[model samples]
Target: MTPTVQSLDHLVLTVADLNVTLAFYTEVLGMRAERFTPADGSQRWALRFGSQKINLHQAGAEFLPKAARPTTGSADLCFLSDTPLADWQAHLDALKISPEEGPVRRSGAEGPILSLYLRDPDGTLIELSNRL
Candidate 1:
């Protein structure tokens, strides 16, 4: 039998500052901050948008079975936007967050994507794109 990879449901991000990370995702990127309690009686945080989420693990306090070398500023993530890239740029500009790169052409999983690249507080390269 062959095992197949279905899709991405979530990923973990180890962060230095929880509040700053939360604010960047929730306030700046329009994700929702949510708190969840695992069966082990521990509280955890996640940033939810659409059907996907990023679980936030505090540095030095990550849960069991984490990445081998979990560290801040190690993630380069891309998000597909429902809105136009120009509007996303405006949103970023209004927040006074300057992009490190462009709204240029890039190849995405589905098709061609027009993208803007920026860094989160953790220095993770965040790509916001719209499929063309």
Candidate 2:
């Protein structure tokens, strides 16, 4: 028997402000919004990040409790960069997105990679990595 295998399609996050989340995903993270359906009559919204499409729906309060917030950490979303750390760091700086400082060296990642950690609008941790 073979186990099921699938690539990550998209991650849906419950956001307080849809515009803010969209801005952060596009302006800050460099993802383009492929399409957007106004919340007038629909209950689902679709956003494109590269080739991936994320579905966003209005969630009720109490979805993310204080106790569950920290435990979720910042690994919910990840993106790989062709540029190295120096260039990526400058990109983040240009956007005024100050990421938490962590180790900077070659590690056994997908390859010789540099990793940086940052948080999204909804407090979701995002990993930006580059392969050497």
Candidate 3:
């Protein structure tokens, strides 16, 4: 028998500026930014949505057990929303954010999804999607 994998809880994002990272996630993507004190007695920031979260680490001050080579602007992540794609487009339009490419169909982890591609302040590719 093999161990069964359930789901993801969190991942980490190495950022250059904590304030900018927190703001982008919380304001642009509609995520919530939170601070927590871990066992090490240090405060850390995280961006959370639904049941998932992404811990933020300063590029030069990361926690132990980090990636072998952590770098900013290296991650390409996709996020899902219950809101329709058209609504997402409007939201982006209101924000004055341009899409690199999008309103295109792609295969999601579960099924089909329509997505919009954009870049964050750190140049990380961020995908906003709707499950179809």
lDDT of 3 by residue, 1-132 (tens): 999989998999999999999888887899999999999998999998998989999999999989999999999999999988788788888999889998899999999999999999999999989989
Give me the displacement of residue 11 in model 1, in angstroms: 0.3
lDDT of each: 0.94, 0.65, 0.92
Q: What's the best-to-worst order under TM-score?
A: 1, 3, 2
Q: Best candidate, TM-score-wise?
A: 1
Q: What is the Cα root-mean-square deviation between model 3 and the actual structure?
A: 0.9
Residue 115 local lDDT, model 2: 76
- What is candidate 1's CA lDDT for residue 88? 86
Ranking by lDDT: 1, 3, 2
Cα error, residue 77 of model 1, in Å, equals: 0.4
> Model 1 — which ten-residue stretch has the worst lDDT?
81-90
| Residue 103 local lDDT, model 3 | 88
Better of 1 and 3 by TM-score: 1
Give lDDT tens digits, candidate 2, residues 10-118: 6556666667777887887677765554445434555776678765544453222222442222335656777676776788899888987543544533666667878
lDDT of 1 at 56: 97
TM-score of each: 0.97, 0.70, 0.96
Candidate 1 lDDT, tens digit per residue, 9-124? 99999999999999999988899999999899999999999999899999999999899999999999999998998898899899999998898999999999999999999999
- Candidate 2 versus truth, CA RMSD in Å, comes to 4.9
